[model samples]
Target chain A: MKYYGGCDAGSTYTKCAIVDETGKLVASVTSRSRINPVLSAQAALDEAVATLDDLKGAKDLAYLIGTGYGRNKVPFADENISEISCHAMGVHVVDPSVKSILDIGGQDVKGIAIDADGTVLNFAMNDKCSAGTGRFFEAMAHAFEMPLDEFSKLSLKAKNVIPITAQCTVFAESEVISLVGEGKPMDEIAAGIQLSVAKRCFVMAKKAAATDSIALTGGCAKNHGLKQAIERVLKIKVVDLPVDPQLMGALGAAEYARQKGLASAKA
Target chain B: MKDLKHLYYLENLLQDANNNLVREAQAGGRLAVGSVCSLIPEVLLSLPGCFPVRLRAPNTGSIDLGTYYMTSMSCECCRALLERAVEGGYKFLDCIIAPDACAQMNRCVENIDLLKLCDKEKFFISYSDVPMKSDETALRHYVKQMRIRVLEQLSGVYGVDVSDAALRAAVLGHNEACRLITAIGEYRKEDNPRITGYEFAVLCTATYCCPKDLLVDKLRETLDELGSRQPDSGKNFRARVVVAGSEIDNPDLIRLIEGSGALVVADRFCFGSLPGRQEIVLNDGEDVLLQICRQYLAWGKCARFMDTAKIEERQSYIDELAKSYHADGIIFEQQKFCDYWGYERALGSRVMRDDYGYPVLSVDLPYAVGTNAQLRTRVQAFVESIEIKNIQGKVTR
Candidate 1:
């Protein structure tokens, strides 16, 4: 059996995954903070290789593909693909019915509409601001004095969500603190924060004019409240895989590697 | 401020200007000869007794600024020069002059003429058909035509003789100003590094039409005072940065960057470095004014101009400066509505990183008041990342 490796070096974290030719995720690893993408990518690749130690001696470990904000930093990769194409490819590989993918990372957010063959048809990205990404939630988490993981869960329990006015994170922080001082419930504030992010993402999705069955990726996808908020605003069903949401870029990269390997073999 | 003494001073200056005896006295009793750009006409007009200022826009930055203007993009240099003209900053001028260098600049000339900043009779719009690659014959013809226009304008305005001697004297005065500027710039690069680029730009702009002797005296004093200052002795300086931006005249941005622990060492800006040391090389030819004009058009890289070779040249210049000055990074400031720098963002970043092996942090400035705190955070984060990279032994080419 042939094996392939994929790495996604993002602004906040580094992720790696290994898969067989059949597209089964044999192993994966994730690390905190992506200060130096090249070094982080090397470390991630080593972890992926170590996870598949049995497959290390496999004769047909054909290709390595890299993608993401820091995709160019992955020196060991045989090829590099755009994160948008990779994200759409990964979403389609897991769920072939997915027509649109909304991937929100640390610094940027992108909404991609994919064709049947997993080609990127249309896409819109928020490159200018951080309000549309997981950074918004991270800021809110900091404001709440809670871990990001716990904050994600807390957002789901709000009964009466109050809306935050500012789209900027700094402005929103002052607004959030003011509301908190006024005796607003923490869960309600969390719900409002999720709603704000959803609103911003909705604008991006609308710009891309994404079709039905949108799949969410990135570290923010782990937030169930954000998922619900997004679904509520867009009036569409959101899709997810069993693996960690952050692994989507790596999964997409591996899928690209597999497709390229098979095509080259046929040639 | 509007006293007759100022007028008398200008009149006496004009009188001294007419007599070759005054020129000889100023030049240590010799014919003072120098060169000046065509744009010197405008600088000349801002004086009390001279004709209008005429200038040609160098083609560059047109596409980027045009995109911002959209339906009004016109030509890049034309738009930039016109925008500056329309700002009414040169209200002191008797009139402004422009040449039909390009269609866009011609349009700009027409638009500027429509504005009532100065006397309409003083406005002289000359059309020159000199090609970019003009031959000797063509240059001579152009120079003759230019001389006629200069004589006519000077005679009409001040009733002074626009003889070769007088023109030569004016050119010499301009050259002396240029020499002082070049000296100051060279002095800044030495052990003390006295005057900053900002102060240098101010001195350059002020010297534009001011009497050569006055400018020289002021600059000499300034340079002396600056040279006497001691070098700053400090370690743990976070990072030395060169800030390049469009219209970074706003001191707030500088304060914000400095507050973030980065020392701004050099810059490529209209209000910063371009105005200083852009000397007119006169000894090469008799048509020194036109030569100066061409040199000014070709001298530096601006958002309003496009020259890939020049851009690379400037990049290398900055890189060398950064290395010599021990700079850590480069901060590119792109103002909103300034589309040229925005389009160059990705390419500029790649060049700085790939070719020069230096990290670049780009900040897009909005016209609105107040700087974005998020941008400040990002800058801090980038600095921290650089520090981390150094600590981890990963900093490399």
Candidate 2:
């Protein structure tokens, strides 16, 4: 059976997904992002291939699509599609009922409205700001001196919600420190940070006219606190994807490769 | 697409406010009347022995000083212009005739006036209270302001001719340039356009920045050259779109949009051909100044025109342009921090998509869009969405 590959060279990490002609995701891998997207993409694909018994490397793939911030820089990509389109496709393929998506990536947050067929009907994104993104959460976690997963878990134990007023990441971190100095509960502050991000994302969702249930994608999608906060602020349900949320971009790219590769093969 | 011969020459002219043609016009004993807003009737400033050079600070790198003075919260276009002034960029102009519109721009001009930046011995700045409402009362106020603040000032200071005959002659020259620019812009309506949006932007912007009479010959030749120009096979663009928004003195925004696979079929923004380059139809019976003011008032679609009728008309105008040009979608953009366009873009984005049944991409852009990756990504995604809709046979108006 022929195989397809997709690489998502995001700002924080490079993810690769390999799929068979039937669109089943056979193997996938994630690695820390390198400064150069090409190197990161190659590394991720090679790591993914190492997980399989038969596949050797990218050469074994029938087609490959590159996506995310470093999409154009992926040298071996047969095609490069924006992460917005890729996310929409990835989510639609996993769950067609998800009409909207909140993709909080490394540096930016996006609100995407999708059609029944996974086409991106409309989208809205934060411009040159990092208030509601993976980076923001990572920074907060770093300030709390804990791992990201633990930081997100700490948010669930909060007894009160402290509001984060500063829109800038640096300022918000300073505010978090001041709150710590004030002897406030760490879990409450953590919940506040998640809620701030959620509030910002709610504005984007409103702007994009997101409706029905929305899926959470990107690295931060794993943060249960953020998911709950998004649902609370948006007053809508956040649906779960069958696959890992962070792999959506790569999966969508791989799906496109499958479709395109099959069409060319038929021709 | 093949480059228009005059494209390079005109593009280079836009790099500096004091370009070769402006110098040539000044050296020939003509006054350079600097202008900032469209409400300041361009024809009045282009009277005999004077020409209007709409102030633009191209290749702007840092607006630190501008930010210090105007504060960072002011409109970036206003800040950039102020920055250029602080850098002695507008030293070539004789005077500035601006509308008392948009508070940020007003503060910018006020700072320039207060600083005495322009060192010309007879340098001056005139502020005219142009109307926001385009009614009969507004027309009279517009005409009266143009007479005293713009016309009388030019005639008084530089002894420039502001007579009815002079205004008539200026209108003729302005109309000639407008006709050429409009005719060139019309080619974008073709299924496969002969001219790219970037080239058309350069041509249209040149008419605004340089002396119209000086650029007329080149525009005429360029327009004639477009007659037999063939478009590329299968089309390079994934979709055709109309760009509507705030002032786009810099064409890099259009280039960025086009580079993302959307062919800009119509321009409905400031410094664009729609309202800026349309011919000023004249009458033999009425006063030339009164007639000019009336036409400009009617054409006012800027968000500063707070009237409910004008706001509704603005949306209708975009719909008409999109339908006429056969555009697949519309891109509503605004210069960041521009309060007028900020609200306009937000409202227009919703109305155009929900009411008009068009796929609209709304964005707020910086003044100089130099390969902004975020904007490019947005445009690329917008193009893909439009393509997908087309493939799905969705009737996107």
Q: lDDT, candidate 2, residue B7? A: 88
* Docking level of model 1: incorrect
Candidate 2: lDDT of B393? 85
Reference contact recovery of candidate 2: 0.55
On TM-score, the candidate that comes out on top is 2
Instruction: Rate residue B173 of model 2 by lDDT.
Output: 96
Note the B-chain TM-score for every model: 0.62, 0.99
* CAPRI docking class of candidate 2: medium
lDDT score at residue A267, model 2, on the 0-100 scale? 98
Judge candidate 2 at residue A55 and give its lDDT.
81
Q: Which ranges of candidate 2 are over 4 A from the true structure?
A: A49-60, A181-183, A208-212
